[model samples]
Target: MHTELDFAFRRDGETVRSGGLVYATVSAEGRAAIALPARLVEMLGEVRSIRPSR
Candidate 1:
């Protein structure tokens, strides 16, 4: 899966962005595997569950 690069300037005028491509591949044992940037992994840790409001 791929996500479009999205970013915005913070109040402090610093840009914050998060977007990356997810790759699908087979593992050494013939199992499905995924890989991504370490920075993206770190960002994932900060993710929170959210509900869409109408």
Candidate 2:
């Protein structure tokens, strides 16, 4: 499975976002709580997937 982590820079009226990719063995655990590999983090930067609030 895969997850897309985006970084949204804070702004007064506009949103700026950047994306990074990460992987997982399963999606059942949900992307929020998944732990990525340290090597991957070092190589690809930090990954944080965000979902819209319900």
Candidate 3:
């Protein structure tokens, strides 16, 4: 399963929003958090999600 993260950048009364994706895997121990590359812009209001997709 994966979780979707969203983020936004605002500057000079302008806003640009983007999304980041994270992944999870179930193993014998428990759910493991997977690390992925996320794309982020300047003036981040909140860290929702920031990842590049192929």
Candidate 4:
């Protein structure tokens, strides 16, 4: 299922800001974490594709 997730920006391992994302998957379960803004979750209906930004 797809859902908006909240998170915070982090300079180190600790979370300094709140930011995350709930991406939709084809499989029932998977191992991976997607980071995104909660406000933009709705904009992404389904996780069509993912690529490394850097």
| Most lDDT-accurate candidate | 2
Q: What is the C-alpha RMSD of each candidate to the true structure, in Å?
A: 7.0, 7.6, 9.7, 10.0
Positional deviation of 46 in candidate 1, in angstroms?
1.0
Per-model lDDT:
0.44, 0.54, 0.48, 0.52
Which stretches in model 1 have alpha-carbon errors above 4 Å?
Answer: 1-35, 52-54
The deviation in Å at residue 46 for candidate 3 is: 11
List TM-score per model, in order: 0.22, 0.28, 0.33, 0.24
Candidate 1: worst-modelled 10 consecutive residues by lDDT: 1-10
* Candidate 3 weakest lDDT stretch, 10 residues: 36-45
Q: Residue 1 of model 4: what lDDT?
A: 42
* lDDT (10s digit) by residue, model 4, range 5-49: 444566867755664665554433556544445566656556443
Q: Tens digit of lDDT per residue, candidate 1, span 1-54?
A: 222233344556654543433334445686655455567656656544232322
Q: Which whole-number lDDT from 0 to 100 does residue 17 have in model 2?
A: 61
- Order candidates by TM-score, high to low: 3, 2, 4, 1
